[model samples]
Target: MSDEPLSIDSTSNEYLINADELSTVQYINSTSQDKVLVDIGFYTATKKDLECLLNSEMFLNDSVMNAYIRILKAQPSINEREDGYAYLETTYNANMICGDTITSLRNKEEGNFRLYRTSTYLNNDMVFFPINIKDCHWYLVVINGRKGVVQVLDSKGTATRRPQLHQLVIH
Candidate 1:
């Protein structure tokens, strides 16, 4: 796709921002009920405009994911746990390599929690991330550092094209 700048809160930036590293952050939702936000704020589309997409079903390209992420950032009660903490998709992951130079990213609106791949990302309280194949489905995996083990949690049920979602985690 296009390597256009990342935009969140109506502001665009040159590169991606790591949501995991951010200590404090804010979010903004598009209140225009009739229009749908496109990838990285490409264009505001009307529901009728996206009718042919998503198997000819009218859909919000990636805005629903954006809203879910906003909830994760705006309300800790959604993901933060008293017993264990978790991470979500980050803005930096927006450009994650998919097949060749292409990225699986569809939204640059806000809040992708994919942590930086470094020892710093693996805190004493956390664990892992790796690739694995299971039942003909390859998982975008993580090694839970805190638990000292590798694991995969497919949030969207089917471990297919859209398997690597960051909405829910079941420990």
Candidate 2:
């Protein structure tokens, strides 16, 4: 992938400003003269042009789309409680090596309420009765030895659930 930023022509459309030229002109005007006169042409992109630009090879690709999807999925669902409390939870990998808990919390007006992992069992044989609250939702994430955010549930009701396991061959 090219590291260079995308460029758009701003000559024909009056609403568009050439950022590079504007910056250069602004710098020169600021340093040289008390009053600066400038005539700049602006460019406007139509909806069809914008769509075509977005779908172009420079913009549309696996890496770009994947990044967009990741950003979109990263947004968490917000829930409001009747007791003037709001809850937010997002799944994170439980790092067995680091012994870190996959936890989440809400930034409340009073204070933050955090939920952390108490313990973890390998191979999905252990039964977990972490907590049960009607007002709060549960977020479960599965991870490997390498800590990474994998599949996650947005929200789960107050019910007992089991962990899922997948076998993989590591070279």
Candidate 3:
């Protein structure tokens, strides 16, 4: 992608833009790789973050998935649900969980990643987890507490998300 400024389509009503957010969007498009582009509560996106968005071949990173999750949590449909929705970011340490023994990890001895805090997703009816496996693909795991359902949505359709599912079961 060229260093051309990112252009917003004025006709799209899907975005909820304010002066500050819009400025960040514009800056990310034109800024150098070293510059920080977006920083919104608990997540930061640098110019390097734009690679996933600009290049179709690149894997979507944690910043982008978390950013999208943040936006999803803000929507009316999500909030209007009877039990509400919560989201876990991409860096929730699914890789570590996939390893042989999570006994030590589950005891909270693992360094505190934000996902360790239950308050973020504990009380919600549905929790959305965006998990990136081996830096190759991302899958969205939706746990519907009210309905007693665990759904995994994967674009590739062949990823066996068994380890992540097993961890969630005991979590």
**TM, every model:** 0.37, 0.20, 0.64
Model 2 misplaced regions, further than 4 Å: 1-7, 12-59, 78-171
Which candidate model has the greater TM-score, 1 or 2? 1
Q: What's the distance in Å from true for residue 130, model 3?
A: 0.9
Model 1 stretches with alpha carbons more than 4 Å out: 1-61, 91-99, 102-120, 123-143, 155-171
Q: Is candidate 1 or candidate 2 better by lDDT?
A: 1
Better of 2 and 3 by TM-score: 3
lDDT of 3 by residue, 44-84 (tens): 77778766775556777877666666666667786556565
- Cα RMSDs, all models: 15.2, 18.1, 5.9
Best model number under lDDT: 3
lDDT of 2: 0.29
Rank order by lDDT, top first? 3, 1, 2
| Residue pairs with clashing backbones, model 2 | 13-42, 13-43, 13-44
